[model samples]
Target: MKGIIFSEFLNLVEDTFGLEICQKMLDENQSDGVYTSVGTYDHRDLVKLIVTLSQLTGVDAEELQRVYGKSIFIRLYQSMPGLQGQAHSTFEFVKSVEEYIHIEVKKLYQNANPPKFTFVSEKKAQLIMDYHSARCMSHVCFGLLQGCADHFNEQMDIDMQPLDDDGTEVRFTLNII
Candidate 1:
């Protein structure tokens, strides 16, 4: 059994669900000033916590299962409606994660040599598409522009133009930051 800090577990839970839900769960599940332990920090307990977090957050179980592969973080975030909307497209979800990481890294190295990160290469783009198809099964292409924005640290705005028949053209513009 790995001796993980309680704060780390809480961070995972908060990442999955927002802070509000995490607090609520803690309040509801706390028994005599201690939250129930799963004995060992295995997959089973993670799954249960995901379910509970999902219930608290109002996310669909099927959707969470599809994207996160029983990941506690994914399950908890998938449970929340707001966060689930954020995960509408796999591209967008991945982009969000990448963006969060990039922002943090940039902040950490603002005064030093800020390592320049490359945009998602063609190979990575294809992999992301494949993963989206396998996990999200969503027809909507989201996050491609957002990912680029994060890579370049630029603001982006997506404009949807309706095309003839039943298609739409999405135009992404990099706004001056």
Candidate 2:
């Protein structure tokens, strides 16, 4: 994972919770709490932070991940003005994730491992997106989809179905409402 993710997560924690909670989480986490935007760290370190935040705030880890995903989406969208210009709708934006955004991510972070997405179907008002990744962060993907809807000012209904026992594979059904 990139350090910017960690930095943003810390920012989210501090903004949502408080400075003390964020500092306590950092103190409890194994990492030294120093992150540069260009650096890379273990993805598990982020998992730990989210889990710790969940424990402290009494929020579900999955929900936290979803909210974190939304935060990430907002940040990414703001930083990449070209992406904004290229995508006119939420569906168009999400469909470009695998081929476009991930490529850009790889260019920026050579070691970054991004999830794979396949569109099962694309209709006039609905899209089915299949997600595959070893990290099992489908909720984050869900949040990203929600963020897309928000960005496009569209009302969307999303349903997630796990393809396997583990969350490494998921099918997301999105409907514009």
Candidate 3:
């Protein structure tokens, strides 16, 4: 996983749960909680942090991932000047995730293992995307989708369907509300 993710997650934890909890979670984890945006780390580190945060906060792990996704979206959008004005709508932005955003990510981090998103269908008010990632963190994708809708000031309804037992594949249907 990317270190920016860990950094942002820790920031979110600190913002939401206070510094003490964030520090405590970090102390419990194997990592030292120091992450550089350009560095790469084990995906398990993030999983461990999420698990620890959930236990400390009494929140579901998936829910925390979703919230983190939403929280990070704005930072990502603002930081990526190249893609800033390229997308004006939620559908437009979501469509660009695989081709544009991930491509930019690959340019920045050659070893980054970003997830794959395939559009199953496209419509004026809806989109169906097939998500595949070995890490199987679709809830984060769902949160990003919601964050996109929120960013565009558009209302949306999203549905997720699991295609495998391991959550490596998921189908997401998003419709403008």
Q: Which candidate's TM-score is highest?
A: 3
User: For residues 31-74, what per-residue lDDT tens digits would candidate 1 score against the true structure?
Assistant: 12233332223333434544666688787644444234223333
Q: How do all the candidates rank in terms of TM-score, highest first?
A: 3, 2, 1
Q: Count the backbone clashes (under 3 Å) in each candidate.
A: 3, 0, 0
What is each predicted model's overall lDDT from 0 to 1?
0.39, 0.88, 0.90
What ranges in model 2 sit over 4 Å off?
none
lDDT of model 3 at position 119? 90
TM-score of each: 0.28, 0.95, 0.96
Q: Which stretches of candidate 3 lie over 4 Å from their true place?
A: none
lDDT of 2 by residue, 1-177 (tens): 778888998898999999999988888885568899778888888889989989988999999999988878888788777786788888889988887988999997788899999989999999998999988889888888888899889999999999999889999999999
Better of 2 and 3 by lDDT: 3
Residue 88 of model 2 has an lDDT of 83
Clashes of 3: 0
Root-mean-square deviation per candidate: 14.0, 1.2, 1.0
- Candidate 1 stretches greater than 4 Å from native: 1-9, 15-20, 23-40, 62-125, 128-177
* Shift of residue 4 alpha carbon in model 2, Å: 1.3
TM-score of 1: 0.28
